[model samples]
Target: MLQETSRDPVGVLVVEDDAVTRKALCLAIESDPGLKLLDAFDSVKPALDFLESSSPDVLMTDLGLPDGSGIDIIHACARRHPATDIMVVTMSSDEANVLACIEAGASGYVLKDAGKLDIARAVLDLRAGGAPMSPAIARMVLAKVRDNKKPAVPQSSPASDTTSLTRREAAILDLIAQGESYGEVAKMLSVSVGTVQTHIKNIYGKLSVHSRGEAVYEAHRRGLLQLGRPPGKRS
Candidate 1:
């Protein structure tokens, strides 16, 4: 496992094909004092090359590129830098594209139409161990999950709900399912970021999930969470 990157001002790598959109996205990330623009590229190969040398704390990429699909870059980042938080900023929301990115380790998916502020905020939330997804993207994922559902779950052994999560862990899991970042959750609960992170780990342990997405999905599968975001979490 890779050691965590120091993310005082979260380091961001952006890959977009369009010159205009690329410039705008980079500028928006730069506009946020809490984020730093590590590098920006308009192609998959160069972005892949950059990842070979330095792993940014966050990667924001468009799905289409001249050389190849952004999904390629996402898979590369997920392999080389598992600690990196990936957000897909794409114009395409096709079911295959959305599912592919998430499977490739993307935790956030925002449409290209989102404003610059939304773009930047998504990076912040992603780096803070949150799954910041567009509402449509969230719906798409949930729809797929529902479609895959069997009429009846195995009455046999599923992960035991009786395992029990602490009240604090339950609260943190709920906020996380609601797409709240650690900083946001800390603020909401009047706790330190460290405190929230600790609870997050405990939640993962109790839920037997290795990632935030898995924790959310497992909780939802167990009826502890309903997999949907409220309004205003576009970032």
Candidate 2:
């Protein structure tokens, strides 16, 4: 159990299309004394509108909303309140949707099958600056990063000239290509996770890649990583 914050209970907003699920989520929020249900909506528009005027401590939503994808909601919350903890509570466990949500700035990913206690715990964990991802979602994320393939060489390529990486940047990319998560890389490098994330952002800019797998492929193409066996596999 977490100590009550000096502030009001953590405000949580829910956006789910299914009436029953939405009601259940509301109940979960209501049951937890540490969390307060700020608002609940069944579509994207109303949710977006409410977000524009108010921001919650946590935003949990299902991806396949009736009006639009929850990625839009994630983007909106991320843009409006950078400190807000955004989570995806959806049925889709595919790599594509998981990656999409991550790219959209979601820090927590929970499957809808999770119990109410689990959902409450996820909300509290997110409030504590933890990334609460289900075990299946965690496996999917790891698989996505570990499944990098060599990108095809283009006819007129400029990314090949990506030799501007600093020594530390290259080192960070190497660790990431080795299937190390940001937290793992941070621990290995004796740096904070935010420091690692900053370096990763710089790496992406230098490599012209958007995600971890793309960064790995680009690093390999640029000879930053030793051409070798599968990533995350120890020799």
Candidate 3:
């Protein structure tokens, strides 16, 4: 068992559309003296509104919400409250959903079939800055990394002079590609959001990409992101 620290009780918000599952989750969270249940919602709209008004220490949400995808909630929390961590507690542990959740900045991913104690422990792990993925999900993430290590198929294209960006610019682009919000990236790097914005602007100027998605795609195409390696390392 992971040892619990003496830090403040982690505040949590549960978002699940299922009545019984949501109730069980709430009960599980509340049962833990180290966790405080802030609110529970069945949809994304109210959850988003609550998040905007009062950010919890952690978010435990389902992937399929009534209003929108749980990725939206992850993105919103990461952007608005960089300090708040996110965990995905859902029934669908499909490869696509697992990858999407990780890319959406979820710190942990557990199946809904997990026992109450297991779920609570996973939440605690997330609060301690640990990414506790279910075993199958872990294998999936590893497989993705391995796949990225394989040699890419070369494509013939017009050789245009490519503008070189600084190391910082490359790092920022990599984080963006990994689905980190500007605020979260800034906090991680111990810089202001404005600084991150400036770096993003410079990155866009150098890469000639306007949107975040476009920039990330261009970075991947140019081998700027080493998908096989760890998050910060260059491939």
User: Among these predicted structures, which one has the highest TM-score?
Assistant: 1
> What local distance difference test score does each model get?
0.77, 0.75, 0.72
Better of 2 and 3 by lDDT: 2
**Model 2 lDDT per residue over 1-235, tens place:** 1232336789999999999989988998899998999999999999999999998989999999889999999888877776577888999987888877877768778887754447788798776545678888888776654575446454355656535677677777777655566666667776777787788778766765544544665566566664343333421
Badly placed stretches (over 4 Å) of model 2 are 1-6, 114-117, 149-235
**Across residues 99-182, which tens digit of lDDT does each residue of candidate 3 receive?**
666655576788867554466777876665456667777777666655765455444643223456676777767776565666
What TM-score, over all chains together, does every model reach? 0.71, 0.65, 0.64
Candidate 1 segments whose C-alpha is farther than 4 A from its true place: 1-7, 114-117, 149-175, 184-192, 198-211, 214-235
The lDDT leader among the candidates is 1
lDDT of 1 by residue, 129-211 (tens): 77877778889887887786554343355465375666667777778766677777777777888888887778767876545
Q: In each prediction, how many residue pairs overlap at the backbone (N, C-alpha, C within less than 3 A)?
A: 0, 0, 0
After the best TM-score superposition of candidate 3, give how far the Cα of residue 112 lies from its true spot, in angstroms: 1.1
Q: Is candidate 1 or candidate 2 better by lDDT?
A: 1
Backbone clashes, candidate 1 = 0
